[model samples]
Target: MSQLYASLFYQNEVTEIFSDRALVSYMIEAEVALAKAQAQVGVIPESAAIAISNIASTALDQLDFDALAVATGLAGNIAIPFVKQLTAIVKQNDEDAARYVHWGATSQDILDTACILQCRAAMTHVEALIHQCYRTALAQAEQYRSQVMIGRTWLQQGLPITLGHKLARWASAFRRDLARIDAMKARVFTAQLGGAVGSLASLQAQGTAVVQAFAAQLQLSVPSCTWHGERDRIVEVASVLAIVTGSLGKMARDWSLMMQTEIAEVFEPAAKGRGGSSTMPHKRNPVAAASVLAAANRVPVLMSSLYQSMVQEHERSLGGWHAEWLALPEIFQLCAGALERTLEVLQGMQVNAENMQRNLECTQGLIMAEAVMMALAPHLGRLQAHHVVEAACKTAVEKGVHLKEVMTELDQVKAYFSAVQISEIFKPESYLGNIQDQIDAVLQEAKGEAK
Candidate 1:
């Protein structure tokens, strides 16, 4: 374990979700559930189910990896070696019971259901961390909704906007992700059970009953069909995870830009010996953003592989089903790490309301040009007001004076209103049009999602 890459990509909590031990544990869980399900329907002896369940609870360390590596590679799946070991272990306790260890299930059934168990565990972690981002962003938005800042478009400051509005936009993406995860839980948690091909011909009359019992034991939704070759549920989970990572990447991108020494509109939380420059002592980098962006860049490739691999050969697949074995775990690991790191970024983020104000001022009243045009619009026609403001902006810049001050010399502005209105136009507070209402609606919707 390179603690460095582990530190970077695999948070201790998330890495555990995709750990070798967890894989074996979940596969054993599926096998035991299958044994119980079969026993309930008389396909397997009750004594055999008890014996297999008892042995399946053995420690992960007791499993022989050297034998499993060669055996599973030949068998093309983990459940084959796992069931082999499980049945042998059960034989030690009850020789007759060992015959029913795996009952009528195929390798894909146990493996697929085991993978779903891992997904449920990994998603549980992802969901908690995402909720952290949503709540933190909500508070920041609500706190700063009226706090004026420079609103930039295409990397150029175009108008005055509240910090709350910017934070609310970030929060909105997480809301959709949260809803997606909730909805996907239904689609992705269904159990996969088919013997050899899509038909449970091995189990004959008892297949459906055993599958229902198996799903009940695992607390997973029962599949409508065998789904041995159908992998859309897996694809759907990966697709939603891609959206989640992409959204986190966007948040990181925004924070990274804002953390620029020149921008300094926000800062990732500062800590001792953290985000420090090894060579230059004066730097505090947005390191969390780097990890998030990297995950964002890499996850789509894995997701695309899943999409391409969805076209499996009839009933079973050649390399297509095999392709999913490693890709799905990696997708979960990378995306889970991104969620965790992003949650850290949001929780510790330093909002520089002062810097926001300073950046808004750096525009030298040009950001308020729209405000001036609109206020003058009611008095003068819209086209005339735009032309007047355009000329006034040029004069203000050329003379190195404020836009409000330069407007005093223009007769078009003087004819429209008093000096007070011109001064008000230059103030950011005068131009926040409906931002409060917009932000309020977002906050309200966020609360609704919480319910």
Candidate 2:
């Protein structure tokens, strides 16, 4: 089925990788490799392996896709029809070779391994995109390390922080995502080669050898045993992808909020016709963030289906295993789209540092209430200091005067500090406790990850 909004949610390269043709190709590759591996272990004649391999070269052209599609509907899975067509193609060249075509493998073996092949290739691109995002975020973090901005809690200004600190947090997330992908490679990229019902019953004596050789044939790892009933590996891949998509979504939400008209501290990268409102002439939207947010919202829901699908009947799943077919590919496609959109946003994201600094003062010095309270806490009791600052804050708000102006007029404040000290208390930079250190720690960690 074709999606109307596929272009908005999937990158062309990713779509190609998970296309029907690619799945067919991967399945064919699995079949050919299986034949060769069996031959290596003396399970099949070398002539059979060679003939099957030779026919596989042009097997795609020889097979009828239209007929295969119709057959798939009746068979309930593509592997059965695919193997039938492959065996028939091999028979035309050498009848004897066709006998060993799929020798001791089941439909799930080829299908699962083929899907693994597709996922292995797809994740390479995902890992690269994440690295690009990590690099871009780190660069931004370094560039804006000292650029002061307001930190919000409960959607209102709470404290002071540097823009670099914010970007570093983003970079840090991508860095961990990279680690997760790397760690999962060993578990996810393993071959699925149990003959039938997670046992090599058909290939009995040489089962272990064939399993090892089959995995080696495709340059995939050999799992300790078959994963036909063990769906954790597949679920783990979905889980990590959910985390990555969630991170991108979070960044998008933050960026979109920053781009709000009243709080224009950041803007999406500008291009002709990009992020423009269709009806509103003065609107500049966060288009990239919108795409990412869409992916973020959808990927998790898809992941849930995969989690639910983990309950296989016994050795092979009925509907449970089948549930993964569409959901996993769609998850990959969505993540690809989200990652690409994130790259575009991060690489050219516009920072309104002036607006950031200006907005910090919009609260009329009330943002600096903590600094003043802490300064007086040493002279008065903590409660007394808090009570005095709380009253001054209310007066500042009611009179429409700055917190510093009200603080200077308070007798308690006057007795403890000079006018110059009172002025310093309201400076956003003065109260940025350890922001540079925190940003430095994030940068150092990112640099370590790069190595």
Candidate that would win on TM-score: 2
Q: Tell me the tens digit of each residue's lDDT in model 1 across 371-424.
A: 888888987889988999999899989988888888867888888768887787
- Per-candidate TM-scores read 0.96, 0.97
Question: lDDT of each prediction vs. the true structure?
Answer: 0.85, 0.90
10 residues in a row with least lDDT, candidate 2: 1-10
Q: Measured by TM-score, how close is model 2 to the native structure?
A: 0.97
Screening candidate 2 with a backbone cut-off below 3 angstroms (N, C-alpha, C), the clashing residue pairs are none
Give stretches of model 2 more than 4 Å off.
Answer: 1-4
> What are the per-model numbers of colliding residue pairs?
0, 0
| Candidate with the greatest lDDT versus the true structure | 2
